[model samples]
Target: MTTASPADELALLTRLRRDLHRIPELDFDLPETLRYVCGELEALCDDVTARYGKDACTVFSPCKSSLCMFFDRKSEHATAVRSDMDALPVTEKSGAEYASCHQGHMHACGHDGHMAMVLGLAHHLAESFDELPRSVLLVFQPAEETTGGARFICESGVFERYGVDRIFGFHLWPDLAMGEVASRPGPLLAATSESTFDFHGKATHIAKAADGADSLEAGMRFVLDAYGYMAEQAKAEPCLLKFGLLQSGQARNVISSHTHIEGSLRTYSDTMTVTAKQHLAELAESRAAEAGCTCTVHFSEGYPPVVNDEALFDLARAALPDLHELPEPLLIGEDFAFYQRHLPGVFLLLGTGTGIPLHADTFDFDERILAAGLETYKKLVRIP
Candidate 1:
């Protein structure tokens, strides 16, 4: 048998990426996507396991959407590499010949590229399985865009069962130079929570303004106070609280009886997130009280911040000479944080250099950049 040359491996990865992109699936209900991924893994791995049903956290269960593949080298410990299998809800407009065939669904966030890189790594492992220093686990996760599938994978106890020592994953980033890889020692991505505030008051005709308790006025006051509070908090540490939607009145002649505000809170630390939410709730209540309105605030438990393991990152930096260190943390959220919380893990960003923001309808990248991602993963798994 002959080993696949670098050119052959690149071609294989490009084909895999395009095939996965054409059948973009969302969340955990990925039948075609899982089938394609598993078919590729079956030929390269020693064993493959498919997980279905509810996660330990009891989150949504899309049957047979997640997969774990192992290559046993008779080693005591294993290194894991993860790739998310979900696609965004954006329609394809990239004009590529291989644009998504599934209407209203596309790989706008580069999951297809991520999967290709990991699959390419699998092929590399098979070519040299006998010489591997430790076993390897390939994780194809679902629901990363909607429900935090990494949480479900962790709860399945696969990491403990495989004796995974450390894990690694990557996101294709448009902001960096082409093929450049980057990460930080800690807090590479922010933790986020969705928040909604409802204000209730009395309604009356405009002629009797004094008799009406205005809910819209209360909402506006809360917004102003919340922005000021967040700005002040940011000076001390990185945090963000901003409202995107505010709904209230219907008629010009009548005072509104209710107002609803929806927003998100993003912070780099759990302590900061909890404290900011508490302060915002107090501020909302205070503003509502001033306007003679009652208010309720709700915050959804979203993904935790993606904090890179310090020692693991240091080791990665020493291993990959091309790896760049990010000067500041990003405000975005990623469920890859769940894996880091379980064991020492490092998340990296591979540059697409296309300058298109993620989740956009026309977002696309050159498949050639995937080779850099594959090379990075190949080196990471070899670390002793």
Candidate 2:
């Protein structure tokens, strides 16, 4: 029950975090990331598998050796916890000596630290499996930054194979106080995904502009109109639409023939999200016809809204410190929402003590949050 002294825990977590931070990988297809994690999991869990693996192994393993022994011979049910792997495409500017050596890749989202703390939890739970009643499953998910890695794990029927009863997960938030873990009972995080709009038009040379259609302008109009339409939804409820990129125009003299508008959408309500998708299709076609070009709006759905299980969160509330209500529904997105959808679970946001928010190039967080996360999850598995 008592292990991983504060000092030892800090030292081990620091090493794990630094090691991972140095080699940040992008969402999905992270072979190196998987290799390193498998090595670590090999030492802790009695059984491990790359469950529903994509880039990295969404590593799954039992903390205990057998069911009867895991339940202390009484036996209740099995449970699982998830920690996301993979970093944002952002370039590292944290200036740490161990900062990502890979160009244009960074763990600005604090996922590196999250991975370590969850590993710490895995070690703690595995070592104490004799005392812990519920058999624990550690899901080291990948591609959470862009797609629904949690969904992949669930769809793989890993839970059915393991006989898991509930799930638990968490994220780092710079807005909250240090050592504080906060959550909402239901819809803790919104459903978010990418929707791309492409416009195709005939290219024209600088001298003969009349011979071609400017698809770039057509894409631009659709982008502008989409913002206006989406703005109304935000005013009504929590929603977000940002056209992050426009790639089409090649030269100053010639208008672009083919243009792509890439962006993201967020909504707490499935109805609103679906509505936004439908609006995207309508606007793309309407604006394209207006500009005498063909336009297509393609949405690469990311993840569903995080539906927190009330029972699981109640268990966390009993175990965690400084539990509080979220200020509001977060517009930011996450793949953890995928886990909440499959099983009754809770996704917490551990306070990063306020500074630069996640996904920023300059993002940094207090390392001490690692201890808070470790203690919180360890207690979550042990007490309940």
Candidate 3:
């Protein structure tokens, strides 16, 4: 087992990266993004289908390429390899030559590299399908940032339509050294959801503030107390309790009648995730009632936890470096979890060297891992 060679993988991955970096698309309904995806897969797939999530539809076909082609649809197996397609609502600061032309939108989360790796695999695999023991489905999904696309595609029945037997995916990680693979068999990702709490009370002049319950103050008190409570009670694992935005009080003289809070909660275990959510809801409800205000909580059900199949991972175990140092169930969330929702799949972290966390404007990763990724995907597709 030659694990994975570096030079050959890097050259092709770099080209794929350049191609994807040129065009960054936002959440669902990216026509251009879909076009590139279909165009790249045309020569490799025996059949191509594209439904724009609307009434629009199209047939994808192949174009001429000097690369030797290799797919035999006669093979009786199929699998889904997903790479997110949407960019975040961010501005590009990297003065790179191929900086995003779309204002205020950027691929801050290494999603561009992800697409490149998978598409590189698609082109390579399509040409070498005859050498593969089975078939693979390339899923260029949009809207992963908002956490809605996975379920939409799952509901759309792409997996069932293709008869996919197993699934696999990867994510970019700057926390690890370049080229390292991070994974845990049981749970490599956590279940997460967003929670918003709105508190409302009677508005009254500050001079007569007693006439109305101070909802703003109540909201403040609740947040302070809630954060402390969650910290103390969260499951003994990776967890988070932070509110990114909070606004209240319309005027200094008038008592604030409403306040809204937007934040997220994470827990490695399913039971803990549910329990933590319930605790937050109860605190909000009770606090609102005590202050003579009404409270409503809205929750966004994000991606579920990712649990890799031990058997499938065993086959590629040798390719991973420092496999023993992988973290315990992570509290991060991923839409790729949906692919595993249908079949045996693993979503591991591909090393991008050290850098700022993903989703930040300054976020960047080592492009060198693109080689490790392309070859890894190619090898996976080659084996029986």
Candidate 4:
């Protein structure tokens, strides 16, 4: 097999990214996307396994797509690299020639770039399989934008079956300059929990305000109290609590019988998340009682914080020249955190410098920067 030159690798990545970008599929139901990715991997990998619905036997048994590729050199342990496969629901507005051909879905989160980089690595590895110091596993995960797909992958027992020792993954970031790589040693991304509060009360005419219990008033009070509580907690440790939706009242003349509050809480530690949720629930219950209303609270245990292994991070920093060390962690959540719980893993950020935030309809980047990400992965898998 002949090795690809730098120019040839870049061209391959550009073509792959554009082709995947055109087919932008959503959470777990990726038919065409799965076919495209699996075809590419099967061509270059020594063994390619495609897991579909009910095959993995995980909680997400309905998940229709995920791929795992292996290059076995008879090494005792393997290095794993992951790339998420799902795209956002936003319509294409970037106006690029290779923009999403799917009408309502788009690769607004750079999953296209990620897939291209990992596939490029696979191609490179196939050319020099005998030269590798250890075996490697390439993971293509789905439903990262909705349900936590990494958790499903972990529960599938593939890592233990393959003897994976360490894993690495990357996300394209628009905050830093193009081609710059950035990460922190610990708590690189926040753990997230989705919260919902429902307040129940009586409804009456506006003219007779005393006849009805005000659920809206109770909900508003809880919001204000939760904000103050979160603000106080942030002084000691970084955390966030914010509401995006608050709906109450059906008409102008009547008091609302129900008020719904939806929001998310972000924290670095599980203890902090528990404490915050307890306080929020207390506040909601008390405010509702004071307003002569009833309340219910629900919290979904979302993905854990992406905490990088300090030893692995040191190894990466020393190996990659363009790698930048971040002083603080970002509040964004990632499913990649799930992999870190089982074994050593490092989540990296590659700069796009496009000024277009992820998940936006207009989010896009120069395909040339994908070559930088490809190089980073190439260097990571070869680390001694």
Residue-level lDDT of model 2, residues 1-384, one tens digit each, is 366679888888888888888888876767777777777776554332222123211244332110111112134566777787788889888787888988999999988988888777766655565577666767787777765566677777777666677877788888888868888777777777787888988888858867888898888788888889988888888888898888987888887889988888888888998998998899889888876789877887677887678777777777765678776777777777766677778888888886687888888776788888888787777755
Could you tell me the lDDT of residue 50 within candidate 4? 25
What is the C-alpha local distance difference test score of each model? Answer: 0.88, 0.75, 0.71, 0.88
Ranking by TM-score: 1, 4, 3, 2
Flag regions of model 1 displaced more than 4 Å: 46-64
Q: In model 4, where is the ten-residue run with the lowest total lDDT?
A: 51-60
The number of clashing residue pairs in each candidate reads: 0, 1, 4, 0
Task: Return whichever of 2 and 3 wins on lDDT.
Answer: 2
Per-model TM values vs. the true structure:
0.94, 0.79, 0.83, 0.93
Model 4 agreement with the true structure over 1-384: per-residue lDDT tens digits: 678998999899999999999999999889998889888876554332222222211111222488887777668898999999899999999889999999999999999999999989888877777678887888999989999999989988889988899999999999989988899998999999999999999999989989999999999999999999999999998999999999999999998889999999999988898899898899999999999999999999899999999999889888887789898999999999999999999999999998899999999999889998988988998886
> Which window of 10 residues has the lowest lDDT sum in candidate 2?
64-73
Q: Candidate 2, after superposition: displacement of residue 303 in Å?
A: 1.9
Give the candidates in order of lDDT, highest first.
4, 1, 2, 3
State which candidate, 1 or 2, has the greater lDDT. 1
- Angstrom error of the Cα, residue 204, model 1: value is 1.4
Candidate 4 to truth, TM: 0.93
Question: Candidate 4 has which clashing residue pairs, if any?
Answer: none
Question: Candidate 3 lDDT, tens digit per residue, 172-254?
Answer: 98877888767777778777788798999999999998899778887888899888887786546667778888888889899
Residue 138, model 4, lDDT: 87
Q: How high is the lDDT of residue 64 in model 1?
A: 49
